[model samples]
Target: MTMTSAMPDGRAERASTKSFYLIAWRWHFYAGLYVAPFLLVLALTGLMMLWTSVLSGRDGEKYYTVTPAQTQVAVSAQADAALAAIPNGKVVQYIAPRTEEGAAIFRVNNGDASSMVAVDPYNGTVLGSWDRRNGLYDLANKIHGTLMIGDLGDRLIEVAAGFGIVLIVTGLYLWWPREGKGFGSVLVPQFAARGRQLWKSLHVTVGFYISLILMIFLVSGLSWAGIWGDKFTQAWSTFPAAKWDNVPLSDATHASMNHGGVKEVPWTLEQTSMPMSGSDAGKMGIAEGQPVNLDGIVAFARSIGFNNRFQLGFPADDSGVWTLSRDTMSNDSANPLSDRTVHIDQYTGKVLADVGFSDYGVPGKAMAVGIAFHEGDMGVWNIVLVTVFCLSIIFMSVSGMVMWWKRRPAGASRLMAPAVPGDMKLWKTGAIIMLAVSLLFPLTGAVLLTVIALDYLIVRRVKPLKRALS
Candidate 1:
């Protein structure tokens, strides 16, 4: 008969582990108590980002810009035509889609407000259009972008983001390896620890794996919210807009855009100096002979053969030009403009800003790449990453709430629980972790310091409220 060997007991291992965990548990509880309200807000905001695509089908790229048929027309020409088409209209703003199939919109206001026309740049035909912000898509954009909070909503989002950053900093300290723990204790779950022991590992272990990604996504979300978002994009691009000496601000034919009654002409820098009859560049804008043909301009754009998905803006000035903006995600190097942009002088038939992916330096490249990533526009791979991030947040939130509930004794979870230190080593280890965590999340960190101080002052000196909070 074979003598079966009795496996060694993990008694010493279990004792040390219990000591470490109980210490980790209470301050962790304290940190959570201070941060949970903020975390709940994040959960809701994150959910909005996750579901934006479904917010409304308005972003579905079905919009268009209309003009005289050729291949392209100056967006200015189309705007002028549109203004003529509807009297007493004002140009609100415009957007050129980054795809050949993409539509350009000229937001115009009448007695109330509405889209005066949706133009199909491909054929210069007026496609479907509507007036007013009553569309389901518009509503979705507002809700997703602003949370119906408008400007105040933005500040709140930013504050929550700051809190998130703090949480990440603290969570990292909590995860720092202590003593001689191996990979299993750090990276994977330990099945044997009971009550909150099992859960502390679960919360921490899961966060350990996903923390880097969580920070990226949250920070990126902040960047998407305000004026900084736009500035960030421009800085990260390869092509900086050409700066000109600030002469007396050139008198823009801007009046034509705001009001429809004026005769429309090609917009250019020279035209801004004086009336066309009075100046040379102004003369170049409108012919004594006739306004330049739209078909000719459109054909010029198609001739250059940029990729199909670009938004084309017509000249807003007297240039009779078309501006093509393409969204290009860079493959290597820094230029944000890499693989982005196309401009055609419809008159001189010259390409102005023919930027490729190499144009943006470090920042531009990073920015374009990030926006594409956040929108799930980079490709299938990014979508997978985004999906995983979303699911992780949901899991963390749910499991966290459950774990908090489970660890409490019956009737002890009235949002107040007494700390009974039956174990000193455990409490000591927990304090050390809390001290480390405070280094990152200063707010939560400050609270932890207060508690230890209390344990010194009141809790040790007296001990009633300390029992309540801990």
Candidate 2:
């Protein structure tokens, strides 16, 4: 079986395949260079946050108590006690305890400062207070979300997350074994392999295993991003206010309920307009003999089945309604399916609107569950699974850098990127795919276009860069 007679197009097919692999390798390398550091940071911070949340809890023991009295003081008395603790402070919200032995948490504001005041439910005594955003768990969350650099950090992280997808895709293609290679080559690393081969084996094997989970994490995390998550996805998928019949809408939104620089409402409800309190348009009214106050609102909330660690956002202004929300997003309830939000007219004592998981659209429902899983709030199994996923991400990022370092020429001054293939036709298809991805992820698209332009205009034109890169 001579080669010329065996297959007329054998050489062309092999060349095409080789070119595809090289293109994939080049993009994979570029994406890894940018995404690896961000992934490492995300993995480390996420791991710390997960353990902190699981072990010590977000509020910590200072927010709870060990004993429960037979008789508890009124909610109003608790609010007064919390007010006395901080001079010139106003009560913003009241969080019900998870159990009888737990203390109620109150959000108190004093001028520019916000603090969480834990009050003993039994006798209305202020147990302790701490700045809401300065807690260790909150610090980890801020770093994880914004790198503590605010909006700029948010955009940069979003770009990294977007390109991370590109890395995963190209990595998989390059990792795919050629014909005659067994499953062990794909599934298991050869410990005997040395240098770059060892790194490649470990990198590909671990990357392949965590690819799906990593993708899920990226998508769910992206849904919280400013542009994609908030403007595009969340705006379209949020719970609509049209469901509320004849309720007067306020200029303020559910975002106003997010006091102390922390999000208290569910993602889908953040943009939903909060209904005003002036109108008596609600269907449900307060119980007989109950006054239109915190006690009545609490009773109303319990009557509607909002139990166990539900949060209550007090009226901020005349138009504001008392908001009672319970969701797995806040770790208030264990089950995502039980997520609910109720708004009550502060004066008229009417239930303005109530939204539950069933009321959510497909996207909203999915996000609810996804966020719970993302935060490792489901159970012990979820914590273990998320921990493994985080560790795998860390390992993959470190291994990728090792591979790149090993592949670079000795004493190289520039990035040793993969060479461009000779045939340009295959790259046209790749360019179109990259364009589509960029369009979907705005920041990623802009970065990719800039890199491509630099490669053509700057990198290839500069003598030192071209030589080093080659």
Best by lDDT: 2
Give residue 462's lDDT in candidate 2 (0 to 100): 96
- Per-residue lDDT tens digits for candidate 2, residues 1-470, read 64433555977678778878888888888788889999999999989888887766676633457578789888889989999999999998888888888888888899899888899989888888988767778888888888989988889999998998888788778888896797689799989999999988988898989998888888899887888888878888888888878799987778777654356688888898889888768976686557989888887788879887888888888888888899887888779999999888888788899899999899988988988888888888889999999999999999988888888879988787888888655887777765676668887888888888998999889998887776
Where model 1 places Cα greater than 4 Å from the true spot, the runs are 1-58, 62-112, 116-127, 130-146, 177-180, 189-199, 225-305, 314-322, 328-357, 410-470
- As a whole number from 0 to 100, the lDDT of residue 187 in candidate 2 is 98
| The 10-residue segment with the lowest total lDDT in model 1 | 261-270
The TM-score of candidate 2 is 0.94
Best by TM-score: 2
TM-score, candidate 1, is 0.58
Candidate 2 residue spans exceeding 4 A from truth:
1-7, 61-63
Q: How does residue 146 of candidate 1 score in lDDT?
A: 59
